[model samples]
Target: MIVVGVDGLRPGVLAVEWAAREAVVRAVPLRLVNVVPAWCLHDGPTGAVADIGAWMRNGGKSALAEAAAAARRVVGTVAVETSLLGGDPRRELIEVSEDADLLVVGDSGMGALRGLLVGSVALGVAGHAHCDVVVVRASAAGPRPEVVVGVDGSAAQTAVLDFAFREAAVRDAELRAVTAWNWRDPLGGPEASERALAEALAGRREIFPDVRVRTEVVEGSPVDVLRHAAAQAGLLVVGSRGRGVLAGMVLGSVSQALLHVAPCPLVVVRGR
Candidate 1:
């Protein structure tokens, strides 16, 4: 099942709907989760404290019901489930991601502009979640979306490529395999670079024998190359680990930059 976390269900509703529809098309179950802040039900010294708490809970439940109904509308006959959680959104999402095949969340929520500079829930889940994480931006438009994945010739990248290829085949969209190289060491020689590129793409032709596969080997930063590629893509997928990010608590440079600047929605495949 693909679990989608909806916080307040604002601007993210469209992206969540699109993701749920994609899951339905893949014949996977869809689960919608809404996290309610505990402070919303806190009892203050003001009069009618109990009444206010009850009202807040009721409002939260109503909003969750509406989000669930909207999801059902987008996904015709797909299996759907809804849950209203109370606590930190990231913690709740991580707890639920245990049994899920994919976890989806919006890049940012309502009132997030003044609150968080970079989307926290998406980054948190992408960094620590055991399952694949899909972070949808506010301006994403769906329908036969394209899949873009990064390849760095690492074992983790192989898993990312496999996932991207399968997703492209299922969606009947183009899959772009990208590799970024920097010409820092001139003594490395072009022959070694060519051999490395070939090895990176080798042994993967059988995965998409008939699908369109395009590779790019450019001389620049990975983040810049990926951001450029993301301009024309519908979805961008990348591995959790790469040649960047020393601490490993967050996404690498390319993935992190794309998360904030990608023109389309982004997916960070974890545990690959």
Candidate 2:
């Protein structure tokens, strides 16, 4: 099943709805989840913890019903279910993600201060989710759907490419394979860098034989280059991190930045 985390059925709910429709069309079950913060409890004598819990449950059901209705309008009939959870939104999402085929969430919510800051829930899920996570921004639109995958010639990149190609196939969109190299090192000339990129992309051609594949070798920061390229893409896919454990632990700067500024939906694949 594809699990989507909803926060009060905000405007960003549309993104997850759209993704749910996509999932339905693919014949996957869609589950809408709402997590009420644990702090909603009242510790004082006047605190109405029971009342608050009841309200949250009722609200959760209503939100799920609305989501289901919206999804039906687009998908006709699909296996859909809803749930209300308690505790930290991020932590709950991570736990629920365990059984999810794809976990979806909004990029930023009601308190967003900037375009670059993914909501805390999204950040936590992107960092620890055991499944694929799709971060959808409210400002995102259009359907020119192109799959943009970041490659840095690491074993982890193979997983990224695999996911990108498969998504492009499912979406019937163009697959763009990108590699960004820093030119600060004079020892590796532009020609050498270009050669390396070509080699990396060349290794993935067989998997995407019928898909229209394009390769880009840019000479700038990976994050900047990727964000620029993602402007016209429908989906931007990248590994949870990159080449080494350090990159994974720190969150690949490129993926982090793209999650914030990319104009399209971002998919972060999690694994070693």
Candidate 3:
């Protein structure tokens, strides 16, 4: 099933809509989840504390109902479910991700402080979730027909390619496979970048014959190149780790950078 976090904000609403369409394309159930802080559930010495707890719960329920309605409006036949969870949003979402095929969350939060970039919960879940995490953002323009993916010549490229190709096929969009090489590095050039991309994509085209792929090898930072390409893409996909990332790192610098700057929804395909 596909799971999405709901917070009664525009980004959250958009996330639900995106997840609903994805559910229809994948023929899976869509689960809408709303998380309440664990502290909100406790009854303090003051009676007002209990009232505040009740208020939070009511708000959560309302948000879930609205999200569910929005999702149904996207596709009436889609199987949509709602869950009201309590605890830390990051922890709850990571646990939920264990059972979900995909986990989606809004790029930002409700208020000014949280609205700056990606919310803390979204970033945390993206780093630790058991399944692929998609940080959904509001598309600035109309429907985009291209899906961009960053191939870093890492072992995780397999998962990145698989996810990118599947997403492109499901959306009936073109897949643009991009590889970037830093110009300042003596060992790196266009030829090396092309060779890495070719090696990674070898024979994978046969698995996704219907997907139309355009490979690009550019000289620049991976994050910079991928961010530029994502301007015209509906979705930007990347692996959690890249060739330059250390084995102990959970989320690579490139993936984290794009999560904040990608103009489209960013999918971090974690190695399983």
Candidate 1 residue spans exceeding 4 A from truth = 38-52, 110-117, 142-144, 185-194, 247-250
Q: In angstroms, give how far residue 210 of model 1 lies from its true place.
A: 2.2
lDDT of each: 0.72, 0.74, 0.86
What TM-scores do the predictions have? 0.87, 0.87, 0.94
lDDT tens digits, residues 93-180, model 3?
8999999999999888432154467787778888999999999876552267899999887778888999999899988899999988
lDDT of 1 by residue, 95-170 (tens): 9999988988877842255556356777777787879888777765444366777877654776787788888887
Question: Which candidate number would show the highest TM-score if scored against the true structure?
Answer: 3
lDDT of 2 by residue, 85-150 (tens): 768777888898899878888887323446446776777788888798888877655467788888
State how far residue 141 of model 1 sits from its true place (Å).
3.9
| Candidate 1 vs. true structure, TM-score | 0.87
Deviation of model 1 at 217, angstroms: 1.1
lDDT-wise, the better of 2 and 3 is 3
Best by lDDT: 3
